[model samples]
Structures are given as structure tokens and as C-alpha cells.
Target: MSSFNRFRAAGPSSLMASAHPGGDSPALRAVRTLRDAASQPRMMIAQPFGPQGERPESDPARAFGANKPHPTAGWIPPTALAALINGLRRWIRLRALKIIDEIAERRMIDRTRTLDSSRHVSDHLLEQLPVPVWVEDESGRLVHHNRAFRALFRREAEALIGRSVAELLPETSDSIPVETRLDTGERRLDVIIGRCRLTLPASSPDFRSIAPVGGRIGTITDITERKEIERRLRELATTDDLTGALSRRAFFAAVEQEAERSSRYGSKMSLMMIDLDHFKQVNDRFGHAAGDRALKLAAQAMVEGLRDIDALGRMGGEEFAVLLPQTSLSGAIEVAERLRKSVAAIAIPVDPHPMTVQLTVSIGVAERLDDESDFDRVLSRADAALYRAKDEGRDRVVFDQPRHRDIFPA
Candidate 1:
């Protein structure tokens, strides 16, 4: 038999028969290879990887396209069928992937809608709450906030969303924030937002671990009124209501502080004790109201006559003391003399039409001695000197002469 005819007889099935008329050529060899691959398994739409992560020259089906059918003889190549099957498989695979993606996308959209609905409900509840409430994402960006929160800033929610805490509170402080409202003047509320760690359970409840979910969620408290009340209460405690001077407790505290400063720094400081002369006679002759008026006038006179560094305090009824920081005994004596003159100048008008009374104060001054670490010694000496002044006759300033005196102690 001729080689060509025998080759044709031994060639692959009709679909894969080579078109080339050449007997046992490269085309025939290619056809043999394709026929072998086709005989093994059907082609599927997949990209298979090799050991080296490379694709081979042909997918099993690609072999069919290379051996097209003989045009004149009207016989199709196995490659043509293989190419058609490959195209069909690819289209079907693409369609399946597209369908899966669409399903996943729909589910995600539904989940997002549900989350948005729940957030809307939570937001409404927060809005109705009396205090301000806010929520931030994991990155500290403002995500959700209530109507009250927006109202605090007087801003729309759209303006605030996606903004960070630093951007919201321009002061950049975690302390009581004096935040500003949009388009409005300053509204000073001590906005106290206590931060707490936000967390999420990343594990099951059986072996739970807390993981940080995000930024912060907290309610704001306005403590402006409470702070103001506290301030007023402190003032009432430390201040004498009738005389507008430091109360006995507050005055003694001031004296002690001044004494400590004087002792530590080796600086001179002085104390004075003053008594309104014939105060009891005036009160008995007129009335307690007249006496109260006289006391108020005397305190006002002392406050006006003294320096800012000086503290005048009403010790008891009709008796007062002055604390002179960074001053010597002579300076205190000068201050006491002025206070006595001022008191002599004061004339108190009682409730009645024809009753106006005059007064005088006997003043005694003492310096903080070198050895004196305690302010009590200075106060006692001043008190003793005050009595000495009263015995010598009222309305005079007497300086306590210490035996061993060092005005500035080292």
C-alpha cells in the first residue's frame, strides 16, 4: 500500500483528520497529538497551573483549533470542535461567575439596608434623649450622632459626619470643652465627655476576648451650674457676709501661708490686731443695728486703705486683724496708724433720722521675729500690744518691741 493511503487509513477519526495532503508530515504529527489528548478526557473551562507556575502552550482543547478542517474536502478539524467547546465553556463559566457576583452584591445591599435602618432607629432614640450623645468609628471619625449632639454645635449632621474629634473640638482638649456653635455666639457650657474604651468580642462567649472596635461613644454632661454653685459655696465659707472680709478661718489660713513664705524666704512680714474703742458703749447707747453699721463702715475703711497684698479679717465682734506680707514692723505700724485714722474718719448713720455715730480703733502691730516660725506668736504679741494701746487710751498705733529681734531671718 502507498504511504499516503495507509496513513489516511491509520489517521484519527474524521473530525481531526489533517488537511495537508503531505504524507506523514508535521501536520499529521500534530493531529496525532491532538487525537491522543482528545481520547483521554473531555475539556473543562479552567486555567491549570504547572509546578513552576506557568501555563503550558495549549489547554487540551486548544489543540483542536490548530488543525482546521480541509476546505475542499469539507471535513472539519478536531481543533475547530475543540475551539467551539472551549468558547462555550468560557461563556458559561463567565455567566455563572457574573450570576454569583450579582447574588453576593444583592445580599450585601440588603445587609447594608438593614444596618442603616437599625442605625436610624438608634439615632432617633439618641435624639430624644435629654443629654447629648455621639458615636465615632474605629478611626475616631464622627459616624453617628443624635439631634441633641448636632444641636450642641448648632450644626447639621451632614457637616459633622466623617469629621474627626480634633476637627469637632477645635480646642484639641479632653478637658471640659468650651465648644462653639455654628453661626451663633459662644455658648459656654462645661461639656464633659468622659471617654470609655469601645470594644467588640472577637471570640465566642465560651472563651471571650475583648477587641477594640473603635473610637468612642459617650454622653456629654453640662456641669456649668453645679460648678458655679460650688464656687459660691466656697466663697460663703471663706468670706464674712456682713463685712465683705475674710472670715476668721480664712484670715488665719492666709496668715499662716504668709508666715510660711516669710520664714522660708527670710523675708519680713507683720501682723496687726485692731479693736474699735468704746464699741460696746455705742452699741448699748444706740442699737445692735447701729453697731453692725459701724462695723461694716470700719471694714470698708480698712479694705480701701490697705494694699492688695494685705488681708483684713474680722476676728470677732468689733475686733479685726491684718496680715501684711513682705512688710516689717514699722510698715505694719504705719498701716495700723492709717487704719486708725480711717476709722476715726468714718461716721455711721443708723436707721433713725437723727442718729449718726463716730468711732475709733486702737491698733497694735508686731513683726515676725527671726526665731518665730509660728504665726501664733506674732498674733499673740499684736494682741498684747493692742491691750497696751487700749490701756494708754484708745485711737493709737503701738508696735510690739520684741527683746531679741531679727526682722529678716536667715
Candidate 2:
């Protein structure tokens, strides 16, 4: 029998009707099934025929007719139909494999292009950065650094790469908030270093490795100008411009602090109030320039006699105050005596040749008492003693005695 007649005998009645060209046929149904399978690429390829070869299967190819035995008398063997179906399955599998390979290749190409673009962007950004930036590997080896970093270090990228952080920054610690000075070429830079953890995408080639790898990113900021500004500001706030002694405000602040400490800890603290004897007379006789010279000379002499912990400041025109921490009344008196002698010895050279003027200071010493909580109270007593010193004689030191209060009405 011919192949068509043999298929008609073995196939179900519904399948035979579908095989015809005019009506809905098995060939068209197979084409529709293939289209659906292509839409769901992940789904397994399904068989078009049933076990008995009675009709096309309903699933996967559900558009085809249901199983119903052929009405003809002579039955064609199913082996022939099985052979045809097997051949069709092989074709479908080969086609599916080809499509899968093409998709995989396309994805790989796109991923490579994306990685290259990202690398280009990163390089551009690093180059454009104004501040020095560097990257180190897990072993603290320098892997990459920007142009600013190279300029600061005065080294080429090739020389810097693979070098350890210790080699680059010998004096700097690896700890956070690292501060170090870099003396490169003729420039001196005060650098502040900060770092952060580095993370990469899971798709990165380094994601699967024998040893874990990560980067340490750091930024270096130059603070040399800032440090200089701070130093100048501190000098202006804390010291007198003319005599190089503590400023009036700074001296009072120091005395207030010392007074609090003495009261809190029951520690000894002494204050001395000093005035240049006949200072106005010198200004009147030798002019204000000589008066300024005399004042400068007197301050220098007093400073030479004082200990390092002693603080001296110009209170006003000719008045000055000293704060002596951890000193008893006797020690303060001793210091005052030495300062008095030192002041008396100072000779101001008025005219470049031979003419000189001698100066002396009257000092009053007051020790912080247990009852005195305020610095002003100590200062008031010291002022009274100073007046007494001036009254008795200039160039002498006077120790203040506590006043006795009368219990009964006078």
C-alpha cells in the first residue's frame, strides 16, 4: 500500500480528516504546536502521537483531533508512524539546541561591552578628581592611584603601583583619620587620610577566587594652610601684641580657671597685681615712646623671674597681673620680691647713646582663701594691697592679710 493509504488505515478517523488539505489538517496543527513551543522555549518538547497511534495527542498539540480507531478493515502497523514521529522529534531538538547556543553567545558579548564601558567611566572619573585618591588591595599593596596622588608623592604610576602603603607613607598609621606630613620636592603638605571598604558586583570576574580580594579606597586632603591660620589666631587671642605677655582678657580667664580649681581641690593659688611706679611721669618727661620702651623692658624682666607655670598679662596701661598656680602665700611673696628686684634693674635706653631710665614696680600678692569662691574677691584684696605698697613705697612687694569681721555692732 502507498504511504498515505497505510497511514489512513492505522490512524484514528479524526486524524484522517485532519490529514486532508482542504479542512483543518495534521500538518497545520503540527505547525501551530511548533509556534506555541517556540514561545515557551523552556518547556520540554512533547510527542504529537499517542501510544496506539490512534490520533494526535491533545496536550501540546491540543488543536488536533482526539483518539478514535480508523474504520477500515485492514490495519496498518504503528511501526511506520512511529518512525516518522521520531524523525520529527530529532529535527525539533537540533533546532532548539541551535537557538540556545545563539542566545548564550549574544548575552556574553553584551556583558563584555558593558564591562568595558564601566571601566572607561571609572578611569575618567579618577583622572578628573582634584583631591588625591588611591586604591590598595587586600594586602595593602597599591593597585591604582590618581594623578593628584602621583603629583603629591612625586612619583610615576608605574613606580607607585604594587608598592605597599608603608612604602608610600612611612610615618603614617594605617588607622582611620591618619595625619601625616609629606615633604615632596619643595612643597610641604599636611595630609589627612580617610578610607572606606570596597565592594564589587557579583558578576565581576573576581567574584569566584581562591583568596578573597577587596580594595581600600582613600582620600588625602592637604591642611597646611588651615594649620597655619589656626596657629596665628591662637597667638592673637592669647598674647599681648606689644609686650608679648598674655592679653588682658586671656589673663582674667586664666585667673578665673585657677580660682575655680583652687576652690574645688582646696589647692593653693596666688595672684599678684603690679603697677609701674611713676609710669606717667616717664611718659611726660621722655615721651610715650620711652614709656612704651620702659613697659616692654619691665615685662621682659618680670618674665625672666617667673616660672613656666606662672601667667602674666597686661591688665591696662601700666597695670599687670600674674597668676601663680600651686603656689603658697610665702612662695608668691618670694616670686613678687624677685620680680620687684628684676623690674628695678631694668634700664630703658631712651637715646641710642648713654642716656637710660630706670624703672621699678609695686606688687601686691593675694592668696586664694577658703572663703573666697569668686576671683573678683581675690582681685579686690590684691588691689588694696597694691595701693598700700604704693603708699608705703614704690618698688616693694606687699602680702595681703585677711580682714577680720566684727561680730558685735560697732
Candidate 3:
């Protein structure tokens, strides 16, 4: 009988474990199985036969399997079949382990590449920003700053790196969108600072539901020029260019506001209408240039005589107006008299010669009534008083007197 047949008759234990003196460990069993399978005869086949000598119509040896060409067809040995099945099982297990390892390695490589790409993009974006930008870590230390940031501080990026934001900009706040002033030598910079917290993407496996890892990112902008322009615009809108007093429109607006306040609180307020006496005669004799000088001089004197709470404005040509808050009719008359004296004291020099000219003012005073809220009503009464002042004399103050209404027509 062949060795294959003899081994099969003895059973599976004889092929796997019985060959080793010490019981078969898994590794030893695997080795012995492979070794035994290798030692089997190369030529072997399986064939079916009937009990009585008879030829089957189908070929009996066709189904038999072997690793090599057989000299004669025969039944396949059971031990050979067992060894082939065991070898196939081992090959499948090894292939599965190799595939799992490959997948794990590929995932690690992809993660690394993604991280590198993200870091490169972040650095490039920060570098290209025009405004000063910086990032701080959780400990409030500046971890990164852009080129603009370095330029703003007038220092090298290397020197500023790893420094705390508090050390560099003492007034910078962690809260967003604040305006601050920085005095750098002779220049004053108006800086606006905005802040935001940095966070990792939600797709990252390391993402946490709590606060982000990095502290905050900040941006700064200089607005000094913008602020200066705004100031100049306000001045132009509120003041007259020729005399530097409130413009006619601005003065009327102030009168309306003061009238509303007086009516609301039952407080006393007064208005004065002033006219430069013989202003037209001065312009005709000395020319318009001299008239302009006289007007400016008159405005200056009036400004100097008035209190801080009083507002003065050029109404038109030679007419001017003053608003006095918390003042009575008598008090308005006193201020008007002082202003008239101040204007009379000014002696303006005519151009192209040593000749000088003097000017005087006529002022009319009227107090706002608690029942009358309209500025025009108070202004009309003051205008009537001014006509009276001019009729009586050129340089004097006149107060509006109360008039009684006639119940029946004369």
C-alpha cells in the first residue's frame, strides 16, 4: 500500500499531533501539516469502480485531482485532501491580514497629507492679508503674526515672535471691535481692533465640543485720517466761512431747539437781533473790501463780549443774531448793550492807506414766552423791537414791550 493510504487509515491525529513528541502547539501543528503535505507523492488521482467487473459509460478517472501527471488513475488519498484544505485556509488568513494592514497604512498617509495642505493654506492666507493680523495661543502668547503686523509695530517679526500680546499692545483687548488711540512719536494713530476665536474643523476626529485649542485671532486697522476728515466736515457744516460764527441755517436750527427746550421745561430764554448801523454807507464809501473787514471785526467783538453759553450767528449781510439760554428780557438787553459797546470800540484800517473806519451796532432783545413754542414768533417780536431801536437811534439796545389786544374794533 502507498504511504498516503497508510497514513489515512491511522486518522487525522496521526497526521497532525501524533508526529510531535510534546503535544502539538498551534505553530508546530501548522509547520507539521505543511511539511507532511510537501512530503506526499506528487502523482495521485481518484477513480470510481463497480463491485462486479464492469466498465462505466462515464470516465471514472476524470474527477480525480493531482499536482502532477499520474502514471495510472487511482482513488485520491484522504491525507492529501486534508493537507490541501489546511494549506488553502492558511493562505486565505494571511491574505486577509495583509489587506487590513494596507488599508490602515493608506488612511494614515492621507491624514498626514491633509494636515500639511491645511497648514500651508493658512500660512499663505495670513501672509497676503493687508491689515495687521495676529494669532495668540491659549496662554495669551502670540504664536504667529503677519507682515503687516510687523510693519505696524515697527519691529522685525522674529523679535516679536513668541511675545505676549499684552507686552506688545498694552491697550489691546480680547473682546472684539474696539477703537483705541496709539501715540507713536509725533504721529497719532487711531486703531480699530477686532478679535475672533480660532477653532478646528468639525470633520476632524480630534474635535472637541468645548472651547477651541488656539486662543484668538485679531485684525487691526488705522483710521486716523478718516477721523480727521470727519472733524473738518463737522466744522464746515456748523460755522460760517467768512466770520467763523454759526451759519444762518445752523443758527436757526439752534433757535428752534432752544425754543423747544424752553417750552418743555418752562425755562426762560432770550433772542437778540443786531444790525450794523450805516453798514451800506460804509461799503459805498470805502468799497466792499472794507465792509467785509468791518463785518468780521464786528463778529469778533461780539464773540469776545458774549458768554460761553451764548450762540452768535451771521443772519445775512450786516444782520446778526444771538441766543441766550436761561436769560430774561432784561438780561438779554444787558448782553446786547455790552456787545454794542465792544463793536463801537473796534477801529478797522482801510486797505492801501492809513485811513481807519469805525462802526456801531443796534440790538433788539425779546424773551421767549412759555405758551409760544415757535421760534418764528419770538424772532418776529425781536425784529419789531430792532426796527424801533433803529428809529430811535443808530447805536442802542431796545427791549420788546408787552402789547394789549383790543377786544373791540375802533
Candidate 4:
């Protein structure tokens, strides 16, 4: 029989099956792989890999194509070769695209997870902050608050979030938005009696320079105790520690201001200079402790007898001054007489002495003239009147004018 007829009778599959009957054999598997890789379904053909344009001596294709009249055993018809080449190109293109897509998908997933992890860590840090911290959106709605903020305002996350930032903060926080617009980047420290609210400028991103920041982070510092200390310090500077009255410097400053007002507006204002009668004797006989008690008693009495608009200040030892706003000369004399009687009525008991010590005050009264804006002049006039009262007698009220003594029987 002719070679072509013989090869046709023994098909390629039968030849492969007869040589390697076992389906799982390595050679059978290699042959199957080559066949599947070289062609699409319904067009599959077995083709052996070999040298360029030539079949290797041991190539399986030799037996199949050997009978062909073509001189080269590796030769394939143009149509079948084109089908095989096109199939390989299509498979490579589709597989490469699929691999590229898988790589891109994995990268995107990793990026998303990384961002989520970073967000969680940052949120935990904000939650653990010591100072009251808050986050708000551009609409001024509260987004998040730290534990400190919740404790200070006594609100839960559910209650605060999505609400207006204005509602979460005190009315004093209004300045924050206004000042934020100024964008000077200065701290705004608003202190109330029990609560001091501090908003840090740099940390908070409220609207743009022209807008309130919708998602802004800010801190609120509690300075209530600090504010209270400052207020006490201010009081210590301007007030007398011993007598609870205005100190000499503070009293003069106040009088100077009032004197200017009196001169400009032609308002009535008066002053009094008082010297405790026989104060030296009391200090000598009862000791300084007893003298302090006497002084405290006298101050308490004067404070109780004076009007709210009046001010009392200790000039020095055994001497005191009074500022009476909106008072005339006659009015000043009446107040001085009343104070004298009140001081005279104070009876301090000394333990060792076992006796009630009686004291009196000599007062000098002066009225601020319409044209005189200098309070030092008014103070000098009151001092001179005080000397006259001391010269004439110990326990009487005298004025800067002549024959202005008034006495009451006790």
C-alpha cells in the first residue's frame, strides 16, 4: 500500500493511544498539552515543536507528515498554520489582559485596606486625647468629639454628632467663627467664672479664610481654675488684705477718675479724712493685737453705715479716707457725723484687760469744686480739715469751710 494510504488508515489518536495507552503518562500529557495549546475547539490539530521550518528527527509530527509529498516534514498547509497562529495570539492576548486586571484589582484592594487602617488608628488617637477635642464639617455640624469633650459638655456622641457646632459650644464660642474669618491665627481664650473655653487657632481648620471650616479639628482647654486665680490676683492688687477695703493706690486712682468726671460734667463728689481718736493710746495700752481688733471693728461699722456708692480706704496707721460719689458739702457732713457715731459705738473687749475699749474718730470733709479736676487738691483740703478737727478737739466732724463743725450727743 502507498505510504499516504497507510498513514490515513492509522489515525493520529490511535497511533498515540497505541504508543502510550495510559492517559496519565508524561508523553501522552505533553502531546495533549501541545495539541490543546496549538488550536481552538473543533479545530484542534497536533503539531510538534521543532527547529525553525524543520521537524526534529524524533519529533512526533514526522510520522504524521512523512507520507506527504512535500519535502519538509515540518511543513503545514497555509490555512491550518494560520488557524494555529491566530489561536495562540488570541489566547495570549486574553490571558495577558486578565493578569493585568488581577494585578490592578489587588493593588486597589490593598490601598483601600491601608487607608481604612490608618483612619482607624487616627480615630483612636483622637478619642484618647486629654483635652476636649472636636471635629466639625463645613456646615458647622459636629462630626466627632473626644472623650474629654463629652465629659466637659456632658453629652453623648449620639447627641452631639450631626448637630450644629454652635449648639455644642457655649455662646462664647461665637467669637471663634468671627475671629477665624480674621485668620490672624491668634488664640481665643474666653473665660467664664466656672468654665474657661480655649480654642486653638492653628489646629482648627474652620472654613477658609473667608468661610467657616466645615470639617475642622479644634481643642478646648479648661481654664476655670486659672481664671479664678487671675481674678483673685487682680483683687489682691487693688484691695487691702487686712480691712477688705480699697488700698490707698487703688482708692486714689478711682478718685482721680471721679474728679475728672466731676470737673467735666459738674457733678457733685465729696471726700472725708478720718483719724481714730486716741488711737495711739489704744495701741500703747492694749497692744497691737487689741489695736487691730479695734481697727477691724471700726472698719466694719463704717462699712455697714455707708451707702453702696461710697468707698473706704486706709491711708496709713490710724488714718482712713472715704469717697462719696454725688454728695454735696452738707451731705458730706451728714455722712461724716454718722460715721463718727458708728465708730464711737464700737466697743471691743480685750480678754486680759476684761474691759470694753471705746474709740472715736475725727473726720475732715471736703467737696470737689466744679472747676477742680485734680483729686490731689481735694485730698489735701480734706487732710487740712482733718488737722483742724484734731487741733480743735478729738471727736468732731469738720469741713474745709469755716465754722463747719457738727457734734451729736452720744
Candidate 5:
């Protein structure tokens, strides 16, 4: 048998002997059976008695030369009882240690999760920012910068942190002139920094700029792309793709805007509606391609005839419009006559035979009145004058007078 099994076998037997004072207790038999079947001494440790007629730590009765006197008919073994108490103590200690270990492990896990969550949240905020932002202390020392700023500068966040703004950006070191004051009460430049070229050590030139406000806040936006897109969109919306003349929608919108500005600024603004004469016949005689060439030629002539400040737009089919800001009614009519003569003089070359197409335009001009703010009323007057020009015969310019019924019927 193994050492533990032997210990187990002897344990309850020893207990049974202790229990039987006269060596004949009834409980002695039951305790003996427990010791014989147990696999380990520890398992038999739960028995309930000490050695018979001996203390818990004493040798066996045979070695001690002890003989038991009969006392009680039924008694528990003292060795078994002592062993049970010791086993209970061991179990309690093990359970307490297990509980402590679990608590420590749980606390460690919670700490790690808290740190990870904080870092994740911080990274997300940096990436989502729309504008470049950087924070610095009162001493102009960089403390925090978002991802936008890092990407633009091509630098790491760690390298920039704790560095002085002046030290990191030598070009902008003197940007804060002597007159401006930062939030830290130190004098610095308060103006926006424009794009300045920078030559790197081993590469072509790069651009850098800054928008530092105070020691604490800085924000910047690269306006190069924004400006370019805005310029292109404006050109497409206003100017005709083929002839470079303003579109119909842009023409009326300009008239309305000019009217409002004139009323507010106490300036005169005029509108001229022009139509090409015999434009349909040109297309009917030649192909549609020839007609397109004639329209482009007429538009160019009208543009050359007007002032740079005057706005002209193509109003679909053969009609066009002109907006004259700060111009009088007579001046508007004179300008329309010039445009008509210019179109009549254009010799549009469209064929291999060197044939030139002749064209003339009819015009209607109207100036804004003192109380005129309604765009619809102004346009009606201009249209009426245009019909009058065509009625009196085409190839002529007509001006509309400000009338009560023309503006508002009584």
C-alpha cells in the first residue's frame, strides 16, 4: 500500500482503540471499518478519537504498556475527534486563500479594461476632428494636437508633445511680432499665417502655414482646393460653356442683386434684353452647325461692345441679356446700340467657300426706379420694350420709360 493508504488504514484503528476504554466499545468496530477502506491517511483524519488510554500525540497502547479500564458502554474515539478538528482547520484555510486569489484577479482585469477604453476614446476623438486644433499652455509649450495637425506636418504626436512651438517651427518662431499679446500675456503675432514655401533638405519644396491665435488655441484650414472649386463652379453656373456668356438663370439673378444693391447704395442699375434678327433663317439656309457658329460670333461681338463691369448672359434661343450697374437709362440705351452695331458687323466664317454670315440684334433697355424692388415688374417692362423694337422693325434699340401702369396697374 502507498504511504497515504497505510496512514489512512492505521488512523481509524488507532481511533477505535482510544474510544474503547475497556477495549470493547460498540463505536470501536465502526471506526475500525472506516480506517480499513480509506485510500489515504488524510481521508481517515476525520475519525473521532485519540489513541486508546493515551493522549492524542502518544504512541500506540502496546508500546506504552497501557491497559484500558472499562468506563462507558458507548464512547467516541479521541484520535478520530482530534483528527476531524485538524482537517476542518485545513479546509477553512484553503477556502479563504481561494477567495482572496479570485478578488485580486478580478481587480487586475478591471484596471486593464479601464486603461484600454480610455485610450480608444482618445484616439477616436483625434481622428474625427474636422478642423486642425492644437492646445498649448501659457508658456507656448505644445501639450496636445489632433490627428489633422499631425498629418499636415508629417510628424508624430510624441515628437511634437512637450516641444516649444518656436523650437519646432523655426520659420514661425518670429511670427508672433512684438506688438501682439498671447493669452499668457506674452507678446506674439495675432495675424493669420499665409502659405509659405519651405525647402526640405533632400527633396523638393513643401508648403507650411499656421493660424495661431493665442498661447492656448490654434486652428487652420487649407483654402487652396476650396478656392479653386468655388471659382470653377461659379464659372460653370454663370458663363455659357460654348460662348463664355452668362447663362439665363445667372442673368436674372444678377439683375435682382444689382437692383437691391442700387436701391440700398442709391445707385442706378439697368437691364437690356437683346434678340438676334433673322437668326432662324441662318440656321434654315445653312446647317445647325452654321447657326451655332453665328450665335458664338454674335455673343463675342456683344461682349467686345460692353464695358468690363457690365454683365451679359445668354437667355436661350436667340435672346440675350445685359446688366449695367450704376448706369443711367440713356447710358443703357447707348450701350445697347453699340452692342447692336457690333453684332451687325460680325462676319462669321463657317464654310470652305469663305462665306461670311451677317447678323443684327434688337435690344430693350430699362433702368431701376427709386421704388422698384420687384424683379418681375422690371423684366415685364424690358420685354414690352423688346416687342416694341421688333414691331418698329428689327435691328434697332428701344428704351422703356418708368410708367405707373407699367409698374403697378391702378
Candidate 6:
């Protein structure tokens, strides 16, 4: 074959071809000469020394002695190529598995972080709430309660969780009508439940019922103290400070009510007007302080002398009025006499020397004759009788006698 054809067929597969043209060719002689020139003395295989100038076993490519590689064949070894392909496949599969495992691990870590974050935020929110909040599930069992609810009942949040609303509150709380608005602390709270309902805002849906999800949520506050404060404020507005009794305005209002009641029920009522005798002299001698003390002492004596059903009031400076419900004229007179004696016998403490002074009061009693006799007419009659008592003596009780004329001129 021509050199061109041989070269083309050989390509990269003939790089290790033999150099010999023929057994005795000149090219073979040149190759042999080159090998002889490069040869060196060395130990023989499994022998202490060369027996007869033999070549060493540790020479390059001595695997098959004197053997030449065939041309037009692949360069790679058959066994080595098989192992290399297997190694490559194994590396590729290992890399793919590593990548898949890394992705799965990252997803797991992310889910764990999300769960932790959600729990942390929920705990933080539960602790910060102020009002007591409880949530129950559809089965009327508690799902959760805020820190405020736990603190209010002096219990732990965990303890209240998974409990029923009935377990936490009394039966009265459960009986409340749903959708019915009610107030707890003077104002109404919006509540919705199986029985009770209020119109108010809730921080959580649980607050509206014992369980929010078909269960209910509940909250409680005490309003009795606030209501009592308002009631006392109203009472103070119409009370006299000196004697701790009703002022004139309150007295008239009460008497009007009593008058109406008496008229409606056909029950008799008596009114008495009282005046402290020599009050001005007491003020002039021992100062107004003594007069004030005398008034207090007289009030105490009158309060002690009358029944609890009777209403007594200070009718402005040194004068007092009384309303006796369900009393006849004779009974009114007896009550007035007792009040007069009680006031007359009271010893008042005065200033400077701290001297005790015995004082007296004049009383005039009047009874309602019929339904037509109103507060005004009763007061007028009592006033007329009061003047008569004062005219008769400084310290005495007098009954209403319209027929009796004033001792002095009008």
C-alpha cells in the first residue's frame, strides 16, 4: 500500500507501531544500534548478578519481552478502559444524589424555622394582651387563653388551655342570653354566646364567646363599686353637710314623693317643723362654732329620738323638718314630744373653755288631713304650729291647731 493510504488508515491508532521494515532492513539496523547505545548494566530478574550479560527485568515496557505493538489499533488498554467508564458513571450518580440530598435538607431546615417562628410570635402575642381572653373549640372546650386570663384567675395559661368554659366560670355566666347586650362596668360590653350577647369590640374572636369557633368567648368586670360611687354622688348632691341629713331641696323632693304615696294608698303622714331655742344667743356668746356644734348635737338627739322610717332634714340654719309616714295625729304629737325632750336634754360642747351647754328646741307637729293636703300645705300648717310653740314657750311641743290664733299680731 502507498504511504498516503497507510497514514490515512493509521490516523491516531498507529502512534506506537514497530519501526522494523524487514528482519534485515536498514531501518531495523538503525533501531537496534540506538537500543544498544542506550542499554546499561543492571541486575537480572530473580538473580544476584548477570550470569552472561543478560538484560535487567526492571527495564521500560519489559512486560512482553521483545514484543512490538500492533498498528491500526486503539491506544487505550481494554481492562483500563472498562474501569475508567465504570468510575465515571459512579461519580456522576454520586454527584446527583448529593445534590438531591442537599435540596431535601434545606427544605427541612426551612420548615423547622417557619414552625419555630410561628410558635414564638404566638407566645409573644398571648403574653402582651391586657384583658382576660379565653377561646374554646367547637365542642365548647378551651383551645387557648391569654396571659391576662391566667393572671386574673391566678392560674397558668397551660392550666386553662383545653378546659371547658363551664369549668372556668359559674353556671350564672353560661345562662346569659346570646345577642342580648349587657353592661358590666357601668357601660355595655359586646358579648355573643349561647345565652348572652353584648355590643362591644373584642381583641380576639374568643372574647365574644366562651368559644369563638362554634364554642364561645367570655370576659368579666365588676361594676358594683362604680355604680355605688354614682349613687353616693347623687346622694351627696342633695345632702346637708352639717347634720349629715338631707338638705331642704332633697327634703322637699322626698316629702312630695311621700305625699303622693300617702294620697294613693290612703295612708296618713305627719310633718314637723322644729326650731332651736336661743340659737342666736348661743352663737353670740360662744361664737358660730358653738352654734354649729349645737346644731350637730341637736341633730344627733333627733335622729336618736325618731324611728328609722322617719325622714329628718336640716331646713337651712337652726331649722329642721321631719316626715313621719303612716302616723296619726296622736302618734305625730308623741313623736314631736320625744324629739323636743331629746333636743332639750342634749348637752352641746362649746369653744374657749370647752363648756357643755344644755340646749332646747321648739317643735310643731302637723298631719296630712286628706289627699288634697300637699307638701306645701302641710309645711304651712307645721310652720304655723311651730310659731305657736315658740310663742307658748322656748322649749315645748305644739300640735297643729288652725283654729288657734297667733298670740301676738300678724
Residue 59 lDDT in model 2?
Answer: 58
TM-score of each: 0.59, 0.59, 0.62, 0.65, 0.52, 0.57
**Comparing candidate 2 with candidate 5, which one achieves the higher lDDT?**
2
User: What is the full ranking by lDDT, best candidate first?
Assistant: 4, 3, 1, 2, 5, 6
The CA-based lDDT of model 1 is what?
Answer: 0.72
Better of 3 and 6 by TM-score: 3
Please provide, for model 2 over 79-175, each residue's C-alpha lDDT reduced to its tens digit, 9 standing for 90 to 100.
5345446545655676688899999999999999998999899889988898877766777687778898888667998899689645765354233
**lDDT over C-alpha atoms for residue 392 of model 2:** 97
**lDDT tens digits, residues 1-410, model 5?**
65545545466546544333456443454445445434232211222245553445454643433333322212335666555555445546656888899999999999999989988896688667976666666566777788877776668988897775446554542232334234445333322234532211111111122223444555545545665687899999888987789888888788888888888998988888899988898888887889999888888888888888888899898888888998999999888888888888888776756888888888988877778777667677787788889999999998887753355341
Q: Write the per-residue lDDT of candidate 6 for residues 1-410, one digit (tens) a residue.
A: 75534543453213222322223433333333333332333322332335654445775444534333334222334444454355445546766888999999999999999989998897688668776666666676767777776765577767776676457554444232233224432233433333333232222333342245466555544444564687789878888878887889999998999999999999989899999988999999999888888998889889998888899999988999999999987999999888888887787877656678888889888888774446788888888889889999768888886454334123
TM-score order, best first, reads 4, 3, 2, 1, 6, 5
The per-prediction CA RMSD against the true structure, in angstroms, equals 16.5, 13.3, 9.4, 10.7, 14.0, 18.1
State candidate 3's TM-score.
0.62
Candidate lDDT scores, in order, read 0.72, 0.72, 0.73, 0.74, 0.69, 0.69
Model 4 C-alpha lDDT per residue in residues 277-305, reported as the tens digit of each score: 89888888888988989888998899998
Clashes of 5: 14
For candidate 5, the 10 contiguous residues with the lowest summed lDDT are: 198-207
Say which candidate scores most in TM-score: 4
lDDT of 2: 0.72
- Cα lDDT tens digits, model 3, 1-410, are 76655654554455444333355434345544544654554555334356653335464443433333654324445665565576546656766888899999999999999989998997898898888877666676777788887887677978887786557653652333422334422222233333322111111222122223746666665655665677789879988878888999999999999899999999999999999999998899899999999999899999998889889998999999999998998888888989988999998899668889899888888888766888887888888778889999779998786561122111
lDDT, candidate 3, at 278? 95
Q: How many collisions per candidate?
A: 2, 1, 0, 8, 14, 16
lDDT at residue 233 of model 6 (Cα atoms) = 90
Better of 2 and 6 by TM-score: 2
